[model samples]
Each structure stands twice: as C-alpha cells, then as structure tokens.
Target: MASDPEDRAAAQRELASLKFAQAQDKAKQDPAAAEKLVRESLTLAPGDEKAVDLLGRVIHAQGRLDEAIQVLGEGDGKSCDMCKRYLSVLLLERAGKREAAKDFEGARTDYSRATELIPDATTALAVARSSEQLGDLEGMTRAIEKAVPLIRPEDTAAQTEFLGFRERTVLAAAGRGDVATCDRWLNFFPPGAGGDGWYVLQLRVAQELYRQKKVDVAVTRARTMLGSTHTDTLPANRKTEFQRFLADIYRLQGVGYLREGKLAEADDNFRLAMEFLPGDDKIKLLRALAIGGHHETEKALQVVKALPKETKGHAEVMAILESMQVADRLAEGDVEGPRPRSRAQAASAETPEVHVAMAEILFITPAAGVNKGIVRQLKKSGIVKYPNDEVNRYGEALSELAWAREQARGLGEGYLFRGPGIDARMANLDRQLRAFTRSRSSSTPTARRS
Candidate 1:
C-alpha cells in the first residue's frame, strides 16, 4: 500500500472530495456536523481550496466569524475563484459584526478586503459606508467610485441607496468645509438625485469659494445652479434666497472691481446683480458709483437722481451724488471753488420756474456747448445772461434742475416744477443720453441711429 506514493495521494484526494460533498449537504441542516466533515476533508487533502471554502462557510454559519475568516484566508484566494468568493462573504459578515461593536477600523479593513475580492456594488458600498464611519472621506470616495459603475441599471433600489449615501457624504464634506471632497461627491450624484439638500450643498460650496476670494469660480458655480432646471423647480422662497445669494456675490465682485479702478467691469457686474435683485437700492447705488468712476458723472448723476426719494435722502446716497458732481466740475476744469455749492445753496438761489427753464435750455442744446440761441433762451429764463462760463452755467443748470426735481418729488407726482415741467423734460433727456451712450458702444448702425 505504501509502495506507490502517487496512488496513495490520489486515494486521499478522492476521500477528501467525498467528505467535502457531505459537508456541503449538511452545512444548512447542522453547521456543527458540517464543520466536522469539512475539517476531515482538509486534513485528508491539505490546502484543497474547495475543502477550505466549505470549512469557512460552516464555521461562519456557526457564528464563529473570526475563525471562519482565518480558515478561508489561509487558502490561495487569488488563484482559486471559489476560495475568493467564499472568503469575501465571510469577510463581509465579520465586518458587519465589527461595525456593530464599534470597531470601525477593523470593519473598514474587512470590508475593503471583501470589496477587493468581489468588486461588486454591494461589497463596495459596504466598504464606502464603513470608511465613512471611520472619517476616511478619501477612502469612502474611492469605494463609492468603484461601486457606482458596478451597479446594474435595472437595480434601481441599489442605485437609490447609493445616491442617498453619496448625498450624505456630500453634506458631511460641506459641513466640515472640505471643498474638494464635497465637490467630488456632488459630481457623483446623478441628475434628479439632488433634492433640496443638493442645492444647499452647492450653496455652501459657493459661499466657501467666495470666502476664499475665488469670486469668479463662485459666481460661475452659483449662476449655473441658478439657471439649472432643479433650481427652477424649487419653492419660490428658496429660489428667491438663491437669487439673493448670487446677487450678493455679484455686488461684492462689483465692489472689488470698483476698488481696483476697473470701472467697466464694475458696472457690468452691478448690472448683472440688478438682474437678480432688481429692487436693491444699495446695488443700484453701487452701479452709479461705478459709472462715476468711469468719469461719466452726468450718467451717474442721472442714476442717483432717479432713485426713490427716500434713498436719495440717505446720507450715503447724498455723499455719492456730491462726489460725482464734484468730479463732474473738476472734469469741466472748474477748480476755483473749495467745494461745489450745496443743494441748500442751489435751492435758496433759484425759483422753481427758473430752474425748470435752465434745464430745458441744457436739454435742447448740442453737446459742443450752448450756442448763441441757447444762451438767449437761458438769459430769458433768468440763468447765465452772458454765458461766458458755459460749462459752469450748464453744470449749475443741472444742479438746479436736480434740486428742483427732488423738491417736486417730495411734493408728490402732481406738483410740477413749472411750465412743461421737469419730469417730461428729464425723461426725454435720459432717453436721449441712454440712446447716445448705446450708439457709441455698439457696432450696429440702426442702434446708433436710434
């Protein structure tokens, strides 16, 4: 019997296979009996992958997870597919038990091993969740990435579960101000997977970007979300809040540009802000300041003058208007005075009729300066009879008209400044100036003509 080692080895292998078959049959009915049989098989054929896998499963069924993991892990899982599959299952069971005991590191390690063996969505997601529990966001992200593509499209429940997990990760990342992690997880969220929580996360990211002085990136992100269909479907109040946030970003950008002396850029940003917050008086004031920075004092004055009377009365608004007026005078080379005449001085100096008549002369005349006819008209109106200082006279007429307009506005819409009134004439002048400005900036001949 001992003469031929080859025959003896074959007989032992046959016995081992028989024992393993019996172990498989009894594994569900009596794990204890199954474990005994699998052990016999492994002893007969040492290192047999099938016998090892069966032993691990029976041990696991008896709730000896650590022992089962050790038995299965001793086999060559890399070379034997059956061994790898069995080891993965046992590892998952052990990981869940570890998680229950608050052994997060052990659980993550076990889950990771299972995922490496199986590489399926279930195991991968398990690893992700375990990694999350351990506060290993980078590990969690990597696990989720692996799980996503492995999920079958028909398995909608799994997809939904994964999305929920991803959303949680995103919010968690945002809560800790982990911008890169937050953005990565957010990208993993499928369209429509992002509910209100998704928008909240996006807003948080945008706010963080703004705080970091990454204004352009923040603006782009917020603007894109604002225009998204998801945002359009939000509750009205929520949409308005989002819009206000974007408007604030734009306003801040405008202020930055103003400080840097980038007048055109500042004006453009404020205009965009107004689109979001059309009734924001503060933003409107900022736009006027930007225009004044461009040396377009009259245009800036027009914007300030058109504000609600209450806003016009604000000290800040008055200061801005006075600064623009002073800049206008300096541009006209009127540097003789220590300060421009105050609104009180202008109001005390002129009657309402005289101010209105002067406004009419300035409105009708060409930009080259007041001609002889216009001077006579102004003289008849009791302003600048000589017209030697045409620039100062024009500026004085504007200031007077501005003061008269404020007075008339205070008295209500029905109280006119005088014949033909300041309202109609001012409106006409604004329209003409706006048209002219547009003509100079645009390439279209029709726009220039209009």
Candidate 2:
C-alpha cells in the first residue's frame, strides 16, 4: 500500500494490470469468475482498456451478451484497437448464437450492434439475415443498402452477393405489398444493375404515382416498365413474379384510364393484363365493364361468356351480361318493361304456353345459383316434403316415365336442353310439354293449355 498521492495512483494501475492478467487465465476455464475479476480491475482503474476488453470477452463467453456490449462500451469513446476488435467479434458470436436459437430479434440487436463497432461485410450480411427472419423487410433492405457501400467496388463477388440479397429484400417487400418502400433501394445501383427486381420496383412505383393523381407521369412510368412506347404493350410470360407485377401495373393504369373516360386506352391496358395472365376473371370482368362502359354490349357479352362456371364471380358475370342485354334492348327504344321475378308473377312464367320459354330463361339466369343455394337451405331446414316431388305432382308421373323412354333412346337427362347444367327433372318436364303440344296439334284436339 503506497502512501503518497502519486504513489497511490501508480500502485492502482499496477495492481489493476495484475488482476486483469489473472482474469485472462480464468477466462478459458471459468468465465464468470474471470468477469468478476475483470470488473474489479476496471473499478480500480476505470479507463483500463485491457480490463474493458477482457471483461467484454469473458462475459460474452459466458453467454451474457447484453452485459458484454455494455462492458465493451466502456472504452468506446477512447481509441483502443483491442477493445474494438473484441467488441466486433463478441457481437458476431452473440448474434450467431441468437440466430441459431431462432431468436431473430435478439440476433438483429447483436448484428446491428456489431455494425456500429465496425461496418464489416460479414456482420452486415448477418444483420440483413436477422432482419429477414424477423420479417422486418424494410430493416433488411436498409441494412443491405447501408452495408453495400462499405464493400469495395473491385470486390465483384461480394458486390454480386449483396445484390442478390438486395433482390431478396425487394421480393419480400413485394410479397407483403410494401410497394412504396421498394423505391428507396433503387439508388444503390445503376439502373437495371440489381436484376429484374428493378423493373418490378418501377412497376410498383408507377402504381403509387398513379394513385397520387400524377396521370402523365404515371402512364409514362408504367409504359416504361413494359418496355413499350404504347401503354397496351406489356411483357407476357416473363418469370412468374415479373408477370404478376406487370399485370398489377396494367390493372391500375387501366383503371386510371377507365376513370378518365379514355375507353380506348383503358381497353388497351386491360387487354395487356389479359395477355400476361390469361383466364384471370377479375381482368376479364374489368374488360367487360370497359366494353359496357363504351356501349359495346355485344362484345361485353362475349367477354362474360368466357368466365369459369360455378363461381360467385362467374354468377356475377352472368348477371352483368343479362343486364347488358336488357340495356341493349332498351337502347333500341322498346316500350316493354323487364320481366317480373316472383312466385305471384308465375301465371305468365309457369303457364304451359310459356313453359319452354320460361325454363330456358331460368336455366341461363344468374338467379339460378342463388336458387340452388336456397334449395340447399330448404333441405337443411327440413322444409321440403320429399326429394320425389317429381312423381307426385300433376303431369309429373308422365314426365318421369317419358324421361325413362328418352334415357333408353340414349337421349340422357337434359341432353337436348339449351342451358348451363343438365337437370334430369327439368329436362323431363320440358320434354313432356313439347310432346303433349305436338300430339294435341297433330290429332286436331283442344288440349289443356300445355
């Protein structure tokens, strides 16, 4: 124990150095003990760089990462190469452990902390990886962006690998519908330097610019993405994601044209979407709407005919086609009102004189789907008397036997019907009415209305 002030200060440094040396030996076999010893050394000599480095390393080796970083921070404001290197390596090991244990957020914290010590490519990649695992796509993207510049341009492999990671970040953002964020990553490379994702990003940007009412710019941006001068010419069957991205761009720009009352341009864009994604109901529906909006009801009807059967949207398409046909007739200046649609109105609908006409119309109507659902509901509610209502009603027994004959003749149920589905019962009723009418007229007899 020294007595004088200068002597005491000198002794403190010497004793702290000695304790730090002991801590180093303890670190290999017993990190907890080494951490305690290093802490005491730092307490005696608060700015001892070796003690700071040893404490961080020992605690980290003991799996106490957060505390290790805190200990490492002790000499952060001062220049000490050993402490910096130890902090960097300690953070990387901690991040690796967290990532392996599937603790993404913890790994992200460690990786990001490592970058603060040194902007190393390996650590930066780890940061991006952890961010991706955490579903922090924007964070992943920013991490890649910040780290890429740190890579020397001559290191082509590192640059190319970083570019691949950047593409992945862009793809993840696309999957989550984070289109606007994709633009921030564009400045990192020259135009088209990052691969096909750059075009995908441009498409999303066009969508947003269109949304914000930048019409000319939006159209220009969207057209540029398609590699076309005309808005109608979009790339087709490009990679799956590229096609989808292009289709989405067309849909937005098409709708924008539609809303602007530019029917021709709208048709062009909608058709381009169709070329990229054939048999897309939503796109087809939009096409029909555009044609109807242009007063081309016949063309619109043809578009509706292409919709897939037994789907809700298909049913809606049927309704739209019927509406267009009605509107087309109305445009021809007819005085007649549209037909009535209820059971009370069934005299005109169900009369034998109108049986075939009514059945044909009902078979093609969109309301048929709704009625099918109602039939299911009726069954579920235990309301229908029997599934054999066909054999008990007037003229029903005759129709059933007639269908048996028709079946023997290889006419199969509804084989001659002119509608969507084949219902054996409805086919029999139509056949019975037609046969009765032919016999009555040919035999010179006055038959019951049918």
Candidate 3:
C-alpha cells in the first residue's frame, strides 16, 4: 500500500470527479440524490467546506432541515456567516421547532457578522407569527416593529399579518378587561370593511351592550353582524349559531311588538323566525300567529296539522289542530266533534274508560305536562272536591301538567298565570266526584227515603 501512493491519489481524484458530476445532476431534480453525492464527497475529503455547504443545501431542499443545520453547524469560524444564519432559520421552520427558530439572538450574531445580510420583511413576519404561536406577545410586537420599515405600503401579505396580530392583541386586551387597549385596537378598524374581524368586534360589543342592558344597541349590533355579507366568513357551524342568535333577536322583537299591540308586526317577525328555526318549536310561531290573529285561528291550526308527527311540537300542535277542528265545527253550528267533550258525559252514556283514555292520550305532551284540554275536561266534569283517593288520580294528571308547564317555560311570560287555573280545575273535579257519591248513598233504599 505504501508503494501505491500515486495510484491511490489517482483513484481519489477519479472518485471526486464522479461525485461532483452526480451532485450536479441531482441538484437539478433530486435533493435526496444530491444529499448522497455531497455526503460522499465530504467523506472522501473531510475538511472540504464546499462539500459541507452543498450537503447542507441538499438536506434543506429535501426537508431534512435539521440535518442541514448540523451540516452547516461546523462552519462557524471557517466558513461565511451568511450561510450559517440562513440555514439556521430554514432549519427551525421546517422542523416546526419554534424554540430553535426564536434563537433570534443567535441569528442576530451571525447576521451581524455577514456584511450584506440584510433582514427583510418576510423574515420578520414569519418570526412574529412563530413568536405569537409560542405566546411571546412582546417578541411578536418587536418583530412586527422591526419588519414594518421594510414592508412597502402595498404589501398585502404584510398588511394581513399585521391586522391578524392586531386582532389577537385586541382579544387579549378585552380578556384582561383593558378597555383602553381594546379601544385603541378598535380605532384601527373602520366601520364594516375588515371582513370577519369586523363582525367579531361587533359581536363583542353587542355582548357588552347586552350585559349593560342596552337592549336596542345590542340587538342592532347583532343584527348588523348577521346581516353583513362577510357573515359567510364564519365557519359553517358558527354561521348556524349566528343565525340562531338572529332568530332569538326576532323572538325578542316579536315580544316587544306584542307588548306594544303591534300584532301584525309581531306575528310577521315570529313567522320569519319560525321559517329559519331548526327544530319542532316552530309551533310557537304558529301559535303566536293564531293568538295575534295574524291570520284566522283556523289557519294557524292548519299549519300545525301540516307538521310531521315526530316533531317535538306534535302533541300541543295536534291539540291546536283538534281545537281548530272544533272551532270550524262551531263556525258551522256543530258544537263538538264526534267524541264527547266531558268524561262524565261519556261515562253517563256508558262510555268505556278505554275509549276515554284513548281520547285523553292525545292531550299528553311527550316530554310530560298538563294541557289546556285537561283543564277543559276537568272543568266540564264540575268537580268541586279534593281527597286522598282523588288526589292520587289527579297527581297523575298533574304530572302530565308539570311536563306541559316545563315545555311552556320557553314560550314566555304570558302563560305563567295559567298554572293557578289548572290547580282550581283539579280541586273542582274532586268535589264533583264526592258530591256524586254522596247523592248515590242518600238515595239508597235503606236511607231516609226508604
């Protein structure tokens, strides 16, 4: 081997030439192949700086960014500062290693060493975003301030990034109850032109207004947000929530109109809400429509009948439907439907409890509770007493009534007075049964008459 020095030297030169050619070919299209060539060249000549830089570039291109960092890491005093600084930044980003990325002080060291290594707006913006994601708000502010001078006025990306930062800052300030900071942030935004940020800010303001009981202002702000074309900027699910909020606004408006005796307007808004509402409570809108005489009560009942059976509103809605049928019958001089109105009337005519039960079942709300029909039935029975045996049967009815009351709570304040009427009807039913029993005993043959 010592005698073959010339031959070994010739073989090394040949190997170097082959690696250079392979690296050139790979550099055009394949980073992985380029990586292999550069690494091999470095292995043959361990002190070659060119081979090390080329290897770092290839690794960075292949997204093995950490490898690039390690390759360029050895060049501190031996190679140019520019390569090391650029390689470090790229390494941190590609690896999603923010701690390494924010080694800005370290980067500044290398950047200061390189004579023409000017820091640009894009670099600063990226660093700012990284800092923000890492919860380094002070660092973000510093980064943006440094980058601002390099950003041209027309640079849309820079503007957008800055606005996003501003939004986060405002939200953070609001969370901290720093009203002065929030107001400063708000001043940067004009009326309605800032896309989703505009709506978000308005929504926050509306919430504050609601908390302060500024109902009109809150409603106006909520309406403005939902009505904006940029409302579509919200995610599909959030858009649904906004729509529901808008519906709630309409519901409140409907109540206001009702209180003001603007029945037509109240009914219109309630109907509009029902049109957009997602669930079975649309019956409420229809009921409002009926009670307000927005259309004939008959028309509202028709709306109820048109709903599917599985809807949450079905039982109350169907009873409304039945009541309308009765109303229509009465309109034509027929007092009642095919079924008798009173249980005692039916019982006196030898009606079976099974049939009565079947008829009464329709009045039971699915979620449980009393209904106006139950009141009507007990009232017609002329019951005027309450006792232990009767109270148990009545408790079952009251349980059903309790469920109805729960359902009604969402309907609003007007129905609160109806509960007392229900209690009175139960008392009357007990009295009638007792009186009937007493009269039956008195008329027996072994009694006074006998």
The C-alpha TM-scores of every prediction are 0.56, 0.43, 0.37
Cα lDDT, model 3, residue 158:
73
> Per-residue lDDT for 322 in model 2?
49
lDDT of 3 at 245: 64
Q: Pick by TM-score: which candidate is best?
A: 1
Q: What is the TM-score (0 to 1) of candidate 3?
A: 0.37
TM-score of 1: 0.56
Model 2 residue 218 distance off true place after TM-score fit, in angstroms: 8.1
Residue-by-residue lDDT tens digits, candidate 1, 261-358: 67678778889889999998877777776766666656866786787757633344444445445435644666555443355234333434334434
Instruction: Kindly list the per-residue Cα lDDT of model 2 for residues 23-51, writing each as its tens digit.
Output: 99999999989988898898889867777
| Model 3 segments more than 4 A misplaced | 1-218, 225-245, 252-299, 302-316, 320-393, 403-450
The candidate 3 region of ten consecutive residues with least summed lDDT is 347-356
Residue pairs in candidate 1 whose N, alpha carbon or C atoms collide under 3 angstroms:
none
* Ten residues in sequence with the least summed lDDT for candidate 1: 413-422
Return whichever of 1 and 3 wins on TM-score. Answer: 1
